[model samples]
Target: MMNIKETIIFAPETFNLAETTRSIEVAKECSHVFHCIFMGYSKKYSYLIEESNFTFIHLEPHLSDKQITQIMNVDQMNGIKHPFTYEHIKERVQNEKRLIKIYQPVSIVIGTTLSMFISSRVCNTPLVYIKPLAYTRPYFEEGYLPSPFTSMNLLAATIKKLFISIALRITYKPKSFTKVAKEENVSLPKYTIDALDADYNLITTTPEISQVYNLPDHYQYIGPVYAKLDVPIPKFFDHLPTDQPIIYFAMGSSGSPNIIVKLLHILSELKVTVVCPMKRMIKSQLHKLSFNENIILCDFLPAHKISKFIDLSIIHGGEGTVQTACLTGKPFLGFGLQQEQRVNINQCVRFGNALSFRKKDFTKARMEQLINHALSTRTIKEKALEIQQVLKDINGPENAAKFLIKHFTVT
Candidate 1:
């Protein structure tokens, strides 16, 4: 048996800890597992990973005075044609190498929006790219951004694309485009590895049905690996009227507090019971709303457990949250903010299991209207059940482990 050393790196704030947990479970079967993370190092995650017998490394960059000044300069010159130079790329590449050497792992696993794209080129190590949650297709079709490029003729669209491409090359050098260009020009250093040539790219989605990007042979859809938690219902959940349906509302970790307040107010006007995860910034705001016996507030609740009792969920469309909602067979009313959330909302809508609203479109009246429409719809409910059945049929984390063992183990 070949003993392997593996490192999985990701940002701490992302809601993909369940996926990381799954990865660790698989890694332990044949190798030693190490975790690399940034920011958000909570006791919950630390305790969880410790129980799995994995080592954790935290990287929090403390910028020097000179480096801070340089970063400020880069920020100010946002419009500069060449914002990121060879020097910038070199600095990042060196930093990554230093971090990896501390662990001395045989292979690395990366999650987050662009970590794979950056690390694969910088560290020159074998890597696996985990897909973050996103909308598949139908959501995008309904959610349109006001685009000058799309409105103009084909010539204008082409011109804008060319201009944006050049601007991106200048600002985010050593990005996917520049990496490919550098390889072709023989400028990529010997230490740099092309992610396009990676051994495998594992996506946490069903590619057979997802509409975003085609699944290449190198890319495998491994389904959702969300962490499951058992949440004890507080006294509040039990007292709420069991006759009427419950609505779950959360703005995720970084969502705007104002939005949460607006949602609470809208829910109070309706007959449905509203459950919100108490956030500090919005606590006072929530207090101002007249409490109908229907409002329930708590600091934190296990979303999966709560979804079982709730008929609908209003969320920021975080991948983990959305997947949990799907597992419980509950339809969602997604309020998407970031690009990734938009993608998740899109997928939910495509699956016919959710509806989405952009942050800008969320008004008290609009929210009430949307919620009422969803409550009246039987199709969404049916779809939710179908997706729930699909989730039940798959052994998500186990299957993902099997794939990793097959491809990553060195003979």
Candidate 2:
């Protein structure tokens, strides 16, 4: 007799590479026990789901390039410019309701999908969120979050923490979100962070890096789920010599091109070889600037796979990038662009696994000093390798799947 597998809907914001990949990895782990259906508005990363042999349903109200940019701006705390209009939210809710009726999912899983927070509750479906440790309530209460502004003194830090505490206590729900919730007869989320709440909130980082304690009963650690891109190795790696130290420089999708350009100018003069994947960000400036013989530029390289060849990494402190570096047993020098990234990098710094600097502290000499220091340091490498062993013992995706299957009742 064949036992039927219950349905589980995975809603990931496909515009963000890390979010999409994290969902895909976990879905792959859950595919055996659950019939996974991936739903999203963006088709940019649809191929990732398709390649993994999952059923992907493309939703309506597709986002434009400008709208995607605005969404990113909202995430970076720039402004309230986004595509979540009242009509759009209404339509999205309708679509989700339709999916729930048709699929009868045991649970709706999401990674940074704000719409699901409302829809899942309205539909009475269990919701599971794969989130970063930095966003958890315990992390916020710890006051480890630093201000993104240039000021790094005690007074400025204290004011920022106070402001954040106040904001978290107040009701800052979006108008469209409130309207949709009201129409559905569902209670609206009082605070902004309430959107991140779920029946099960799985933190995607290890305890050593986060160091956040006293989590709620519902929140659990699932280890780090970093990108393991399935791509062929670049041929340039063959020509590079092994005698010199190699540095992997990646300013992820959210990093600033201007900062990358400035750092490149300094790196060009160094004796170490630099393998930078910045073609997408610096396409217009590539022809104007001449590259050194030691520097190699490419469109992309799987950072997890190439960690063996590089001595150290210089990156914008993104969650996925930081986890990848730690998992691969390599030290990194992080330059965080936003508050979340700052917190991620700061956590690593606390663990003595990496060093970091702010954008305002950028200098030619400072960059050179940090790069040289990271490359020459033995303690950082040992600590990173130590964390790698810890990460290896726990498979984040598999554990997350097990937790979901055990906790939720399949209909």
For candidate 2, give the lDDT of residue 241.
Answer: 77
The deviation in Å at residue 276 for candidate 1 is 1.8
Q: Which 10 residues in a row give candidate 2 its minimum summed lDDT?
A: 141-150
* Best TM-score among the predictions, by candidate number: 2
How many clashing residue pairs, candidate 2?
A: 0
* Candidate 2, 18-66: lDDT as tens digits: 8888899898888888899899988877788888888889988787768
For each candidate, what TM-score against the reference?
Answer: 0.69, 0.91
Off by over 4 Å in 1: 1-53, 62-95, 113-123, 133-199, 208-214, 230-235, 278-293
The pairs that clash in candidate 2 are none
Clashes (N, CA, C under 3 Å) per candidate: 8, 0
The TM-score measured for candidate 2 stands at: 0.91
Model 1: lowest-lDDT 10 consecutive positions: 135-144
